[model samples]
Target: MTEVSRTRPTEIGLPGPTPRDMLRSMRFISREPLAFLGRMAAEHGDTVAFPIPGPPVLLVNDPADVQRVLRTGGRSWSKQTVQYAAFARVTGPGLLAADGPTWLAHRRVAAPAFHHERIEALGGLVGEAVDDAVAARLRTPAFASGDVADLAELCHHVGLDVVGRTLFSVDLTGQAAELLRTTGSAAELVVRQGRSLVSTLAWAPTPTNLRLLAARRRLARATAGLVAQRRDAVGPGAASYGDDLLGLLLDSDLTDEQVGDELVTMVIAGHETVASALSWTLMLLAEHPAAQDRLRAEVAAAGEVSFLRHREALPFTRAVVDEALRLFPPAWVVSRRAREDDHLAGRDVPAGTLAIISPWLVQRRAEDWPDPEAFDPGRFADGATQRPAYLPFGAGPRLCIGRELALAEMVVVLARLLGEFRVSLPPGYVRPAPETLAAVQPEGGMPLVVTRA
Candidate 1:
């Protein structure tokens, strides 16, 4: 009997996918990953290998296999050098890219800020932000020739405003331009410099590496400024918003510097994912007006007072967001490393192997979904799915802490936007689907027509 160990092959049973073929597939997958993965799974079966160098890459398509790898089999995996190598450029040791007890500890400390009860309390802030965004949207040329604006960008502003009020008690409306520039530049640096091992080398400092360092410094400065303002706001006998993320962290064991890193991490996590989700939802709604119509009717029935206040009453709006997340999850791919030799979907996995389980592929599998490409929010009616697949916030114990908050934010924005305005994608929009190291975002921007309903 052969005993599997660390030195043994980490993954097996993936018929025969060469490292080169896997790399070539990666290029095409980068463009249309969902379709590409569907083709690969069909051609190569359940388990397929991608050519990522260092170790063999395993692409798990089965939901059961995905569950095994993420939960029961997670101990055999790690966040590893690959994911951290890039994200560490900005977040440092924050939970997103950290591994082991450190990540767990940070998650524990940060958990209070996003708990369901705490999130429900933030509805007031979310509502205020939505109101501001709506005002700005109405100011657009909807009265004249009906100019199209970027719904995703509008959502980003909304997310930023929400994060600002709820996290730091600072309104980001005035600082949004600078904030956007800093985050956008940081993302570009990660994409360019964080991809290769040579760039991440600490011993040799290159121009790219220097740029990454500078980006982090700028981000820290901005974060620190916000923190200082909040810390000063702690007055005598004043009721503090200690439950908000920033307030919670301010009371945590993390130092101001550490707090800054985590704050930036939260800002990006709190904004980008929700913003992309909102953008994708609008895009899908534009493509499927019937779903939008149903949502509008539901919101109207729920009451036109305000969407964020009536979150509990708008089931159809929630369904629309859920379906959008299924079809186009912002965090579409889950990547991890095997710490020990393991078997996935009857395939033997060697230690140190990188595994990618994609919701983008799983949610729309023909076996799991009927007419998978079609936009149908009715499929997710009543907060249920036809299959065990569809994990927009991820799965297992490591599921996203901000899941409820993101959902609430999305529902509020969707209900409000659809309640007051009719949406349509601009002619020949042809925007490329999102490509990023973290959340998905359309390549250029998402432009949509907004007319008073």
Candidate 2:
């Protein structure tokens, strides 16, 4: 590690390693971003400057500094970086990739659909999807015949189905397989762009670009078809098709392209990240049987629990989810580009600097979390006070809009699965390395053995 000043002084020059440090940092970040960020914070301090080829790049690990950049200094930063530019190809100007007034407009139109009450009302939809997966996939002979099933893939399918039903009131179980393949391909393309400085060349007529274009077209057609169907169904003299998100967008003044962008954004961002979170939660539970047993007991006590109605009663189960998010946040890294010069934690930062915040690193700081690596759900028990340090879903105006939905889905799935079956890693199983494709996910998939509890 290159030696640099570790102290934080008001208005001090940015401190980071030399140019050589940038090359090593890039290599490690490409392979293991969570580890790389954690190591940087540990060796340096909460804020570490890195000498990239272009403008200054700072890795911020302190919660206070993170809040300043994401919450207070939000106006000075924008998502117009290479990271979100890649997402815009697929998501367009939707809430995920949009910034400034466009983002605010989109958020206003879509926020009502994700209200706490509205999301709770969609709990039944989530439960239905999980039940279908349990019956048709998890409990089937193929999964029960001593052959391990990839739980990550299973969750992804169920997540996509849930989002389709809840967002558009359409059942996508039949199209789940194809949608998963297309979305995965598109996601890999975006991840590549995020890692490459030549990301602007993504529009080139290369084979990869062609494949990405084709994938985007397919997804657009599917979403556009749903929007048209809903519009036609609500024409004059037609009965209302209920107020799903599609119905809301159709009733709004958003153009077809804008509507399509939001649809694709919801489909990709809504499901994939939740699936990864659930997968990692399950993996953590398998690794720590005590926590798993406690969760199972909590679920059993609340028989036929409704996530919305009885979530307060299932404290242990909720804590397990919270702890899992802390350890392995699906959206592990959040990046922003400074639109103007700013000060973070009293350190002077120049304009056009890249600010990187890793929830994986901040949550694991020894100062905030005792025995940070231990899988202890009790840390989030009732009256526990670590809110400022916890940011699994991010913070500020740009915080994830689907946070409530994701939490509900995870809680419902975990309760149902752990209540019905015992999940464990297969013998000789090795934890897969984490990959930052779209979201932080296991490189291959999480394969676990399941049997009746």
Candidate 3:
């Protein structure tokens, strides 16, 4: 009874863990989610149908199937799942959690700002913001005095600065600490909501939901201030609101509430997601000297950090980024609810079944990544990242619109930082445990020692 099986359930015709296994898994699911999910999939075959109270919850692990569910088309699969419904509590019906035709139209209007070429054009602005954030956030007296720095914290600050400058044309660094804290609190509450069927009544004045209410209120105010500030800066009757992403949104026909929702999405996604990626990449680099040296050397040889100009020249540095993303994808698990009866992975999934497609599982599959645990950048040296098993950004219609911007932002931050700072783990350093949040974040923060390279 303790052993997991690959055999299909006679009733449903799908393979999964038994009810007993589910009961025992609760002890570690909160702490070792990735390990737990990986083992369940490996033992139970591609789709592991977990027995949740309300509906059938399946972890879709097969690469082809994960893509298929995501690309299922029309209203067949939606963000009505627990995870996204919880996320929408904080983000409103923004791009991250929105669905249907209106979401499609919003995507079209916002797509141009995230285009590869447009992100490339923002490279200089990005580089400036990175330098400014590093100077202000990382070069503190503590770091100057030879104390180890919580580099993950600094990455959040820097990521916020760059996102604000390049996308919104605002200076959010002054408010970074408070804003980051508010967003972080909201993310934790959202995760809690996703895990429990009881928490789905978001309107209930339960303590957890009450705290989420506070966080969302603060976020709404912050978003309004951003919109109002942009209006004031551009002034009335100006020819344009300026060409930044925020400007495009402001010029669009989206209502005030719609604009606020989109801004909240960008603020959280842009800062928290990129910060998590940069933090993990730095942690990986600090552990691999040869790889770090090669990346730094590439930046040194190129004489520039702009991806627009040096993307072709810095293959290894970019590979380091790709490999790091492979190891620690920010948006780890994407969930969807079946809108109607449908077949999936050779099984009849009933309408409203909760299906989770995790990037963590897909990226770490041994079939796609040989020695999936190793931090080898050479796997991507060829610069081909269109692998089906890799959905660091979720697949199909809901694929992250900010993919180009996130990649460019990461390259700029890593290239510029490694260009000057020699980063390494301090003596007696222990790797932090990964926590599932808005991203796969280091439990505490990634602390590392750095000096001039």
Candidate 4:
């Protein structure tokens, strides 16, 4: 990970794992990130600092401190950490990976497409996508054959379809399989790169690198094709096409390559992330039948699950999605490179040090979350999903721009699906372990027994 830490900081000033523990941390992070992070916080408290030679590595597990690191750091903190480096291989310089002025510039061009009123208008669009998903995918003959359905795959298709209409103003069902495959492949490859840095060598022709390259090319091709088709249909040099992400980008000053990168970023961030959230929520609902039934009961009215209706309609369903995000939090861990010395949880962190804050850790802190390990949607029952220590979509300056869109999508999906199907875990089925790829998803996808509601 490249950072501006040109010089090493003197003296380790914070509580953390010993040198021996650091070595073991490497193994644990590769094997089980959540467990390793939990162990670290349990042993060293919220603001644990690693005694590394270069800069300093600190774990800011406290919620308030996590907020400070993300919100107050401003330009003092950069996203040039190891995590973003791996993700940038596939995302290029898109908004997710971009920083400082570049991020601001890209966000400016992209913001209009995701404006409040615009996303609010997405209710009908999201409804259409979910309606199609239910009819075309879930209501098929195979699902009726008593075979468990992989709702993760279905969620991906639902997410892609929603993105297609909302972002590109067209249906993406035909390309859903390829789009899902490439993005999923890229996410897995990113995890490989994160685990062992050698996978980062894209030119080496290593198996993971070769596959990653192919995935990137495929994603790039998909984005390019969509952008080209949209632009051509709109006629050359035309400023306005329609009210969508592609339309907004076509009017921006960004180059074609930059436009493609942004589109790919949105698809991955907007689709894969949302799919993971929905999948995890479904997994939780599957395990807790009462919650599932309650969600179904809440959304009994077809007119209740509108996009921006989160405040009014389907409150229990909203709480279910909120608690699911609190537990799974698709983007489990986010990192930052401190440009200068800073403080988190009252501990001094040297400049260039990597600050790792996992929403999984902070949100799960028993202090903030009583009985943190339990799966309870009652935590957010008051129609309040935001508060201290909940960094699902993150906090402050770099909070996900698609936060509202993602929430809207997840609520619509949960409300509609629960209203139609009754899902339960297969008999004697082992709960799939959480696998951290592009997102923390159920290993092998979420397969559940589905029956009509």
Candidate 1 lDDT over residue span 1-453, tens digit each: 111111122235455355545455555554556566666676666677654556667778888888777774337777775546678778888877777887787888888877766666777788889889878766555544356777878888898888898777788888887787777777766755433322357545888677778878888888999888877778555465367778877777789987888888887788888888888889888887887888888888877434334445877788888888988888767677789888777657788777777788888788888998887877867667435677788777677788877887888888777878888878886745666546778767788887778
**Model 2: lDDT of residue 355:** 83
lDDT of 1: 0.74
**Candidate order (TM-score):** 3, 4, 2, 1
lDDT against the true structure, per candidate, is: 0.74, 0.81, 0.83, 0.81
Indicate which candidate wins on TM-score: 3
Where does candidate 3 clash, by residue pair? none
Each prediction's RMSD to truth: 5.2, 2.8, 2.2, 4.2
User: Model 4: how large is the Cα RMSD against the reference?
Assistant: 4.2
Q: Candidate 1 versus the native: TM-score? A: 0.88
Which consecutive 10 residues in model 3 have the weakest lDDT in total? 1-10
How does model 2 fare in lDDT?
A: 0.81
CA shift at 424, candidate 3, in angstroms? 0.9
Task: Give a tens-digit lDDT track for model 4, residues 1-453.
Answer: 111122222266567766655664576668887777777677667776776667777777877777777886457788887777778888898998888888899989888888889999888889889889888877776558446888988898899999899988988999998888888888888877865422255577788778877888998899899888987898976758677888888788898899988988988888988998999899899899999888787778646555786757777788888898889999888888888887666566678878888888888888888999898888987877668789888888788988889898889887778777888989888988988887888888899988887
In terms of lDDT, the poorest run of 10 residues in model 2 is 2-11
lDDT of candidate 3 over 332-411, digit per residue (tens): 88888888998888888898888877798889989889999999999998888888888787778788888878887788
Q: What is the TM-score of each candidate against the true structure?
A: 0.88, 0.93, 0.94, 0.93
TM-score of 2: 0.93
